[model samples]
Target: MTVAIVGAGAAGAAIAYALRDADADVTVFEKSRGVCGRAATRRKEGCRYDYGANYVKDDDERVTRLLTEELDTNGLVEVEEPVWTFDSAGEISPGRDSDERKWTYEDGITQLAKRLFAATDATVQRETRVETVAREEGRWSLADAADTVLGSFDTVVLTPPAPQTAELLAAMAWDDDRRVAAHDAVAAVDYASVFTAVLHYPFTLDRSWYALIDTDGEHPVGWLAREELKPGHVPEGESLLVAQMGHDWSGDRIDDDRDQVLREAVGHVAELLDDDRFAAPDWTDRQGWRYALPDGGVTGDAHRSTEDAGLYFAGDWVAGEARVHAALRNGFAVGERIVEARNAKTY
Candidate 1:
């Protein structure tokens, strides 16, 4: 049997990883040049930073074991400092202490997917955007935007954001009520927008916490983190701050001029940190995630009803959480279900 997984993000990668020992051929399609989706990483001028997701916390035991025991842990690093909290009024306070482990790669957070894909025999096709999915004669067919046939598979799993997945289902040629139900359920999952600003300074910053999050969600900057806390990310005596603007603020200026957005983010960061140096970063970068975080999950029965038709969905939205661990867990569940179905048919 053959399986085609769309969007090589954390969920997609986890699905492939879970099916590594299964008796099926798995092919993953990714629209971008790189994988890991929102848990992204980039390097610039000898500094590596995770601009999309700061780090993955050990919220799930399965994911924790996968990272520490199952996978190669060579470059794995943990943040020692705690996360502080701030309010809309810019009043900073010490957050509650917790023993949660924050994990990331010394190279960057993207290594999570890269490592997962490396351990599997699955084929990863980068820069391949699967535009259409069609079911014909009990098999599934995928095509590109220009109607170029990619391949036919026995099963297809979609791991894109809820909106993108809904769009794909809407365009698919499968005329089944399950498809419509899945589409509606997936479409109803709302997302929160986030605009990230990477600010770099030539000097170091003295701070006790690794990150500061907006507790009430009313601040312009929802999250601010020091990339230097992650080993091998920033050079000594230098600092890099990852500022993620609040959902409301990001949605409002998502399409604004890039320079203007960066300026406003820098100003907000400076005021929040009470440091004028933060306002004048020596270098900067920015990214706009229109569908950064999902607010809700799809109706389980609606999506599960399509599984019998060799169509499945897995992602953060499907798991009803915006965390990377949740996405990985959901992918594992979906992949295991597919394997079980295949085994049952053989018996």
Candidate 2:
């Protein structure tokens, strides 16, 4: 069997790794240059920081074992600091006191997907965007932006966000009710926009907690985390802060100038920490996620509907939460389902 996966994030990588030992030829397509979609990391001038997801929390035993035992390569470490929350009024307080363990790699969170991909035989084709998919005689065919044929596969899994998946399906000329139903259900899954500003300072910042979250939605800032807390993320004697604007604020100025967004983020962090020095930074970087995360996952009906056409959906969106662990879990489950389906065909 031949398999083609779109989006080489956690979910897609998990699926490919699970099928590595199987009698299948797997290929993964990722539009971006790197993997681990939102659980992204950026580096500059000997400094690295996770500007997307801060870290991965091990809530599921399987995920725990995967990180702790299976993929326990070098540099896997736990974050000891607790997460604290701040209100719209800028009052900082203790947040969730869960005993769950948070895990990250010294290189970056993108190492997770990189490790998974390395453990698999799947060919990861980065900077390749799968534009269309077609089904013919029980086999699946895919194309790129210029309508060039990629390949025909026994199965194809899509791991992009719900909205993107829906758009792709809708644009395709599939006449099955399953495709329509799946597209509609996935289209219904709304997403929250997020604007992130990465600020680098000349001096190290002193903070009681690793990160500060806004408990109340009355503030322009949604989250602020000192990336230097993760050790190795910042150069010694320097600091890096990742500030994310609230959904409302992000949606409003998602297309605004990067300078304006950085200015607002600096002001919010300055007020929150009561430090006037935040007004200036040694350097800055920015990224805007239009579909940062889905508000909710697709319904069971929507999931099953896509399966009718040798199509599978996997992502944090399918797990109803925008977390790395959830996406991995979903990916594992979807991979198992594909393996079973392939075996059934053989019989």
Candidate 3:
């Protein structure tokens, strides 16, 4: 059997890992130069920061075991500090912390995908954008944006964001009601936009919390975290703050000039933290996530209707939660389903 997975994000990586020992050939396609999709990381000025999804939470038992036992724990670190809360008025308070374990590598959160793909024999093609997925005579074929045929496979798993998945389905050369249904259902999934600003300072911040969240979802700055809280992320006597603007704020300014966005973000951070020193940063970086978080999961069984046809979908959107663990767990479930189907010789 052969399988092709699209988007080398957490879900795609997890699926490939789960099928590593299976009697099948698997290939993964990623558009970016790196993997892990929104669980992204970057290094600048000797500071490493997770500018996307932050860290994975110990919300699922299976995922916890997979991280702690299955994968290498060499650089694994747990964030000891708690997360506090803020309001629309920029009033800060404490009390939303939990016993949930927030896990990330000393390098960054992207290590999750790196570690998973490392354990798999699957061929991961980076900087390769799969623009087409067509069904051909009981099999699937994929093509790049240049119309170059990649390969043919017995099964295809799509782990991109729902909007992109919907586009692929709409353009696929398949004549089935299930295709239309899946496209419609996948297209209907709403997503939230986020604009993240990375600010660097020459001084450190003394705070009891690892991060701060907007409890009412009415604040311009939705989340602010100190990168130094994560081990090996930032140097001593220095601070790096990741400020993610709220959905409305992000959607409004996502297309504006980058410099303007960074300046405004700095002002917002200063106001939120009640520190005039934050008004000016030694250095700054920014990333705009147009489809940062899924508002809800896909509706109806359209996604499952085509599974018997050797097509599958996995991601946070499919799992109904915008978390890395949810995407990974869903990928594991989908992989197990495919393995079971193969065992039964159903496909």
TM of each candidate vs. truth: 0.99, 0.97, 0.99
Cα RMSD of all models vs. native, in order, equals 1.0, 1.3, 0.8
Off by over 4 Å in 1: none
lDDT of each: 0.94, 0.86, 0.94
Q: Rank the candidates by lDDT, best first.
A: 3, 1, 2
Quality of model 2 by C-alpha lDDT: 0.86
Q: Which ten residues in a row have the lowest lDDT in candidate 2?
A: 300-309
Which consecutive 10 residues in model 1 have the weakest lDDT in total? Answer: 338-347
Best by lDDT: 3
Candidate 3 versus truth, CA RMSD in Å, comes to 0.8
Clash count, one per candidate: 0, 0, 0
Task: For candidate 1, give the lDDT of residue 137.
Answer: 94
lDDT of 3 by residue, 30-92 (tens): 999999999999999999999999899999999999999999999999888999999999999
Q: In angstroms, how far off is 136's CA in candidate 3? A: 0.7
